[model samples]
Target: MRTTLLFAFLLAALSGFAQDNFTITGDGDGFQEGDKIFLSYRSVKGFIEDSVTVHNKSFRFSGSVSGPVRASLYRNQNPKYANVIFDAATVYLEKGNITLHSSDTLRHSANAGTPLNTDYDELRAALRPYFDKLTTLRDPYELSDQEQKDKALVARLKSIYHNQVDLMVPVQFSFVDKHPSSYVSLVTLSELIRDSRWIDKVEGSFSKLSPELKSSVLGESIKQKIQLGKRISVGTLAKDFAQPDVNGKTIRLSDYRGKYVLLDFWASWCGPCRAENPNVLSAYNKYKSKGFTVLSVSIDEKKDKEKWLKAIKEDGMIWTQLSDLKGNDNLPYKIYGITTIPANLLISPDGVVIAKDLKREALHSTLANIFK
Candidate 1:
């Protein structure tokens, strides 16, 4: 069974939580004083992590930007949020054609975005004004310290996220989707799609991408499980799968005819599966007398056949347990989308997966109700 973590994170700047930011480090630090420093950035117009890396010294000043970028200095600043930027000798990148760079590579120079491999005195040539505005504001009494901090942090990220999303996706998508072999879109869009309103919109856009990009985009992202209130409902004929059983016996789910089957996807190593073993064992004991059968598919590693067989005997598992000892590649794990452990499908005598994620207690009652 696979252990998957659900996604959590709001759209950055568009959600209004991004700190103003910028940076400038070009071609072995060729920039000089009176040189124009230009900054234009966005927040999450593309992917959250996507951003541009600049290696140019002469940059045009936007004077005005899309998502809360600013132009500020290193030296003269307030104490509170001033820590947000870098500091240089009495020199500040505040005025027009702001000069940049210092004798000490360790010293702060001019960069609006996050700095790496540099000490203090680094100025945020980008988003300077926004940080300035933020620092100048008096702390509001209504908001608690933590609350204010949280609000400020989100605001900062939003500012960056919103400005970059558009540029990031188009350029990155164009470059990545260019090759049939490239799978950047899938990786890129995976973080964007969710089980919410955004699903349709994201899916639609994904579908419109070039054929080369489309498959890569949807590969791992599409939700296969039955979500509550989703268009895909319970009682639907489950997808058929072909997997080999123990002793090298091939098992096609469609081949199970005329008998109700419980395709239980589990592993001996999974705690949840082991914990629920007793309930399954109990169910087997009761239903085995009534013609119901279980197919315990183990995702144990290839070398652990003895361990797999031993776990079954130790747990007193009496039903038909099958495993190829190939871990995740076992039949049921792939056919049924087994990203989680201890998963089961209560198939009718005809082979339809009736229920999923059924806890032991619920499984017992459900079986009783169905059989009765």
Candidate 2:
């Protein structure tokens, strides 16, 4: 009887000892000491709320988290600004300049009954592509031309990384809905927006989610950003420009005010333009008889002037050819936002831009519709 009583006492003491850590008492007394806490108390991981270590008087969570992070107690006094979002799914913890790799064991709270280990595995699997893509390329922002050639493997690996991230969005969001927690949705949605196609589709999708989920983090703030990208696009008027031509003759784009002007932008080094010359020559022949004129503008440097003139002559350019001989100072380019080589603009006689990116058949069809 004595031995049995001793054994029972030891068991009770061990149970009490195990329960003696952090005791939670927040808005909801939902967490206990052994329960793993997700650091992000905000919507979409804005700041991290670290793990709480309990002492005699109060429970304390103190450790360095990388991102905007803080702490909050369970009950009212909430001395710290740490956000404690009350949803039970999976929450991801990440630090700056560090990758939360596949091999690392992620921790979670047992009290909430969260399957965090599995959740963490999925999150890691989803995030792998982003880190992989980043490491593949030497930072292209400051790469030497020769270095780029030497690192072609980087491009291939980077493509794999980007492609993987794209693949993860739908899968990650599916996990969000399956888990049914604010924390899960917050993290999944954030991942979706990072370099996402869904960024373009956020409003339609964001509007459909739980009101708090959308409004708290992915709310009006994200809406404004999307609207900003919608400023103006192509198919707009080519802004007017005036620049000196080959013989130092000044020409304003407005000069051909009442004629069908094919304003062509090309550079001396443009191989596609050289190859397309035959088609352009044919189109010119067919249409020149019927109120058509081509104005070819070159944005070549002065050192390449001879090459420019020779290419024009060799390619049988019968159209009026002009140049500014200042590469980026091609005034028309700045006006119309010509970002690529061999861009073309078509202007009506009354100076309204009717078509852009006009290729062989499309060019013919646009003219046929306009002239007819």
Candidate 3:
């Protein structure tokens, strides 16, 4: 009788472990029998990838995750053109029997039978209208080069885009507020922090998350980012750092003390940075005599030093340019917690950060007001 009881308990324990596994089944009318499907997600061990060929317009992937993880599923038509992803859809990978259905492109795929996925679908549905409007407003072919150069027209378009995004922010906040324990909520908050304007609110929302969620991997990352954000936020003293210039002469941020400086962060490979160089050059030329100067810090890698020098000459950026040639690991980048290019801080002569991420008309107007 004792031996039989022990066997029963062992069987139940193994059953519970098996229940933690996940099986994902996909059904798509667009998928042919030979079509290939790819799944990618991060695990405790790091990034993991799996692939399977479609059988009878369906595919399946079985795996286990330590916790809820955001994952992507897509089809790559040609292995040689791996960069091209088709019918891609994002789904949360958790323990469950999840189903994906798409009559056409997976971009419009629907997921069900999973807690995180259900919440994600609901949130996406709620924000679809705003996203649609923003998409239409930002259609690249909607404006010609000449039309893009029209400042008034561009400003009006930008105003509309900002208004749409403003309305969408609250929906995301509501989702997080309603589902404090959901991994989807944590992911949403992480994205919200990217816009520095929302840091305060993001921090507040982060605080309200369930204790378990707060202790999650992504949660800790967001917490660190929030701390970094506050450290470099406006009204704080800008941290000083030194880097080597093209001449291999080390220069310090403190060297520019007593002068208004636009401490610019950029890289040669960044398209937006290259496009904004003309504006930076214009601001430097107009304000250099008025106690204002530009100090550009390139995040280019060691191999791209020649490209960085070429871009400077091409853009006619005559002000001081510096780089440690450490790619994204440069000291100043870590000090300021810069995650994006074409970012700049307008620092006062006294070494306080007066403003940040100033670009286009805002950059000109701020300098004009200061030098006026």
* Residues 1-372 of candidate 1: C-alpha lDDT, one tens digit per residue: 122222223344244543333333322243444432223223335312112223343323222222322223323233234534344222211222333444432133433222221211222322344455555544332345575456444344434443343333344334324432323334444544422223444455455556544443245344332122133225888677666666677777677666677778778787757766766777888888776778778899888887888889988888777777778776557766565677677788776767665554567788898889
- Model 2 scores a C-alpha lDDT of 0.54
In angstroms, give how far residue 204 of model 2 lies from its true place: 12
User: Against the true structure, whose TM-score is highest?
Assistant: 3
Model 3 bad stretches (over 4 Å): 1-19, 29-33, 77-86, 138-167, 269-279, 285-290, 310-316, 339-342
Worst lDDT window (10 residues) for model 1?
Answer: 114-123
The residue ranges of model 2 lying beyond 4 angstroms of the native Cα positions read: 1-237
Task: Return the TM-score for candidate 2, rounded to 2 decimals.
Answer: 0.40
> Whole-model lDDT, candidate 3?
0.85
- Write one digit per residue (lDDT tens) for candidate 2, span 1-372: 999999999998766433111222222233334444333354233544545433222232323332221122232223255354333323332222211211112222221212333454566566556646656645432456565454344344434544554566666666666554444455455545533235545445555566665555344555544453232133455467777766788888788777888888787688756645555666677788788888888888889999988898888888878777888677666556554556577887777676665654556677778667
Better of 1 and 2 by lDDT: 2
